[model samples]
Target: MSINHDPKALQNPMHVRVAAAFRIVELSDFEARVLSKGYVSREDYDEAYLLYAEKMTAAGFRVEHLLNSQGYYVPNFSSAARDALVAKGDPAEEVAKFESEQWTTIQNCELGTFRLVNAIFHEQSQPSGQFDS
Candidate 1:
């Protein structure tokens, strides 16, 4: 038996491109400032996470990427993502928890990156780089 792993078997190319574009929206100055702190509590982190996620959703990225709850920050998995994981034989509850945890980790990374970028900027009086428009 052979498994078909063709690229065409995946999502529509246009859909993929649109998704990529939405995810690539540049961080606004305010959002950048909020995440630039060296240390923030989970509560603070969630605030920034939701802010970024809201921007992404408004820009047309899937809403599934955002947290489903204000207090808990649970990740919202799209039906397609959930179905795919189940099809791979993973238990549904476990998969949901895993995905939610993964999103939390991703939020941590986002905050870290903001701090990192600020660190780089602070390392030199004059950081010089050109951003592509």
Candidate 2:
């Protein structure tokens, strides 16, 4: 597949679609679509993500490339907590290592549950009656 070297082409819907497809869909589905259409490939996804990271960084956003649980390179938006941890003498690598060591499957499951419950409570507490039709 020929690579588009133009940076403006990164704004093309095809690039966004390809990147979103790879990120959100199952691997098998993405691969099947690529094989059937020949419009985009895994390389396209990587290029699109790279372009996005570059653009975001140029705009002064700190984009940290972190490995997801599936071992894929995912871009994480910078957080103040991460910055504070780094400022306190713990290197980013050390913080990542500590996070990996402490973030177990059970902890992730509990966090998911906590987030869901929090969302439900937040929704319930909203003034829905004010917007009643």
Model 1, runs deviating above 4 Å: 1-37, 65-133
lDDT of candidate 1 over 44-119, digit per residue (tens): 5555556655644543345454333333344442444555777899987889897786566445444423332332
lDDT tens digits, residue span 16-91, model 2: 3433433422223223333234344335445445554565555444667676674344556554554577789997
For each candidate in turn, the TM-score is 0.27, 0.30
For candidate 2, the per-residue lDDT at 5 reads 33
- lDDT for 95 (candidate 2): 90
Q: Model 2, which residues run further than 4 Å from truth?
A: 1-39, 79-133
Using lDDT as the measure, the top candidate is: 1
TM-score of 1: 0.27
Model 2 residue pairs with clashes: none
Q: lDDT for model 1, on a 0 to 1 scale?
A: 0.42
| TM-score (C-alpha) between model 2 and the true structure | 0.30
lDDT of 2 at 34: 31
